[model samples]
Target: MEFGEILRLSFAAIRGNKLRSLLTLLGIVIGVFSIIGVMTAVQVLQNGIESGLSNLGAHTFQIQKFPVMASQAEWLKARNRKNIDLRQAEYVASRMTHALYVGIESFDNGETVQALSGEKTNPNVTVFGENPEGISTNNWTIAEGRTITAADDRSGNRVVVLGKDVVSKVFPRGGAIGQEVKVDGVRFTVIGIFEPKGAALGGPNNNFVAIPLSTFMAYFGGNRRSLNIMIKAKGPEYYDDAVEEARFLLRTVRKVDPGKEDDFSIFSNDSMIATFNDFTKYVKLGVGFISFISLLAAGVGIMNIMLVSVTERIKEIGVRKAVGARKANILSQFLVEAIVLCQIGGVIGIFVGILAGNLAAMALELPPVFPYDWAALAVLICSIIGVIFGVYPAWKAANLDPIESLRYE
Candidate 1:
């Protein structure tokens, strides 16, 4: 038989059993959809996280009483320990010579405020307290005025820097510099306005106030110790060396023995990424298991449908053989038909899955990502399943005795 005739015969056979063919394809559609959709969504989220992490700046790390990426239980335990106050921060700075800038900052979230403008004051803002060095450490940029100076920090000056949101809420007319905004009843002159930093994985960065470290300690005293210390490595090449120096210095300050684990935690950007990756590994595993289950069911459905097709076409096979049709021709026709069915279903499923994944990502406020490699793998898997499951039925039909098949049916 010609190749054209073989293809025509295959389509005719499929057309003869439309309901059965659709039922077989349905399993494949569901299986491909489940895996492809999840993978696309994961890809997008991973990209967003990496972008946020990169924004943390280069050659910088933090040393604190607590780890940067700890669970709630670990955080609670760390909070209960002795605070790593400003004294410890000073000690680390005095001892460590590798770092370029060592900044100490302690902050309280959700601090309510009263922004007064002749009785039209607002009361929804967050306040932060940090030294001059916070500018480089947090990669914050000044939009209108100067950042807090060293003299400002030392004098405990009641000066404040307004975030973009604070400026809009308190000074809607746009000239907020040198204006006064009250925080917990203490007045502060707005020294600068920070450009919007947008939202980070931690939360919104444009809803807070930044005051001098001394002013913060005096106004909102919490053991006069440091809540967190940010250190900038001298250069990218010396980041590891700086971390080691900081660690050694902190251990010495904490009076930790050389043989014992360090009491304080040192966290770098790489460590943060590793922590996030570990957390996502379990989610990936769950997705893989569910996809596996669906694929297995689809494979079984494909095999069962192929066997039925073989049985229904027994008489046709005998007739073709009587007319000198080769066994190889019969085998090729059935094999190609099975593969085409699966490939079609897989193509449709992949497109639909990607659409669904992108929609879900948008709803979650994440960027959309297309996983070309995953889609290609899905297509390859469908083709492989077709060949593996279609073989038994094709072989049986090809080997049937023409005389017996024709006589019996």
Candidate 2:
């Protein structure tokens, strides 16, 4: 018989056993759905991190007391290390000739801030103590008024730059500049407003106040350790040299033994991104393992159903063989039926997975994603599963003697 005739006969058999066909499809559907859903969600989060938090412009890195992502053992070791103080930051800045800008900042979180105009008050604001070069290093654009100047740092002036969130709440009257806001009971004049930078992996970027390092040290006290140094290379070509020089200078300043590991951590935006990708790579592997287990179960189900199908159509198989239907034709018919069933399940699973995954992404505030490559792979895997499971049943149907099959039923 022709291939088209065999395919039509396979469809007729499936339609004749509608309930059984649907039951067989259920296993494959669930297997594909489990894997595709997880992959789609992970892809969406990766895309978001790459676009929003990955690269801090270009050729920029930070020197901090602790690594961005560390284990408990590493954290304990880092905690024992001496803090990156402002004095050390200044020393490194002065020695680094290849750097275009070097800025130092210290942060105090969960401080209460109140604008003392009338009775209106807002609380819980983050405060940053930074030098003049911090504006350029952080890539912050002044939305209104002027940025902190070198004179402000030298004189220890009580001037501040308000972030978008702080400006809206503290200075609701439209004019935030020249106004005084009390930060932890210390009053400081607002010198500028920063442009909105949106949310980051850490938290909201536009929800803090920036002040001169000298004034912050005086009010918040300079005794606190833990300073973050931001450095921007002169150009992309000099990025490696700048980082090497910074590391050498810092090690020298900290008086580290040449053989011993440096106590400080230095990392760029690219390093952070690579760390995140490494973490997600494990997640993908885990998901794949789980999907494999499900698919294995589904393959067993397909085999069982195909075996029963051969038994039920024993007399029909005998008639086909007696009427000149070749064994290869008989095998091909059964195989096509199994493949068609799996493809049906795969298509449904892909659709459901995409919808479910996008919904989860929306809940997490990430953009929607469609995993096309995974979908194509799903279809291909389903076809392979069908062949593996259908082979035994198809062979059994093809090898049965026509006279014996006719006599049995």
Candidate 3:
């Protein structure tokens, strides 16, 4: 018989036993779904991390008291180290010849801010004390009004820049510029408003108020509080030199011993991205293991169902063999049927998995992604499973003697 005729026969047999075929296909569907769904979700999250979380501009890095990824022991050691201060930041900024910009920043935690107008208030607002260069180093753009200037930091002026969220909340009536707002009881005039930055891995990026470093130190007491130093190189070519210069300056200013490790941590956008990828690698491995187990179970189910199918069609196999059907032909026909069943299941699973994965992405506020490679892999795995499981049953049917098969039924 032609290949087309054999395929038609296989479809006829499946259609004849609709319920049984469906039950067998369910296992394969679930198996494929598990793998594809997990992979899709992982890809989407990874994409978000690479694009959204790595916000540091080109050739830029930050020096802080703590490491971005640290063990408990490292954290404890870092906690005991002296805080990076505004004076040290300024020294490094003034001395580093290869640097294009240096920004000094400190945070005042647990602060409540309210407009003097008394119309609105935020119970918990982050307050940042930063120098004038912070705007460029942090890659923030001013949406309305002017940013903190050299005059503001030098004169210790009580001026502030509002994040989009803070602006919307405290200045609902608009005209936030030149308005006075109380930060933890100290009054500050709004000089600028920042553009919306949305949320990142570290949380809402635009829900804070920025003030001059000098003013923050005056009011919040800079002692014992760690300052973050942001530095940007003139270009990518000078990034290494800039980092080395800043490190040397910081170590010298802090009076670190020659043999001992530096107390500060310096990290760039590339390091942050590498760390994130390393963490997600393990997540992918765990998910892949689970999906593999499911597929293995589905393969077993296919083998069991194919064996039953061979038994049920024993008389039909005998008649075909008696009519000059070769053992190879019989084997191929049964194999094709098994593969077709798995393919059907694979298609359904891919569709469901993509849908479920995108739904999860939506819940997390991540962009939807279609994992085409994973979908193709799912289909390929399904085909492989079908062949591995189908071979045994197909061989058994082909090797059976026509006379015995005919006599049995």
- Which number leads on lDDT? 3
Q: List the residue pairs that clash in candidate 3.
A: none
Give Cα-based local distance difference scores for all models.
0.79, 0.85, 0.87
Question: RMSD (Cα, Å) of candidate 3?
Answer: 2.9
lDDT of 1 by residue, 265-383 (tens): 77777787777778777877797688768877887888888888888888888998999878898788788778777887788889988988888668757677788998999899889
Best by TM-score: 3
Clashes of each: 4, 0, 0
Q: Which lDDT tens digits does candidate 3 get at residues 49-119? A: 66665456789999999998878999998998898877888899899888888988888766777898785
TM-score attained by model 3: 0.87
When superposed on Cα atoms, how far off is each prediction in RMSD?
Answer: 3.3, 3.2, 2.9
Kindly report which residue pairs in candidate 1 clash with one another: 85-225, 85-226, 86-225, 86-226
Please give the lDDT score at residue 250 for candidate 1: 78
Task: Report how far residue 188 has shifted in candidate 3, in Å.
Answer: 1.8
Query: Please, what is the TM-score per model?
Result: 0.85, 0.86, 0.87
Candidate 3 Cα errors over 4 Å, as ranges: 1-15, 318-329, 351-360, 398-408
lDDT of model 2, residue 173: 70
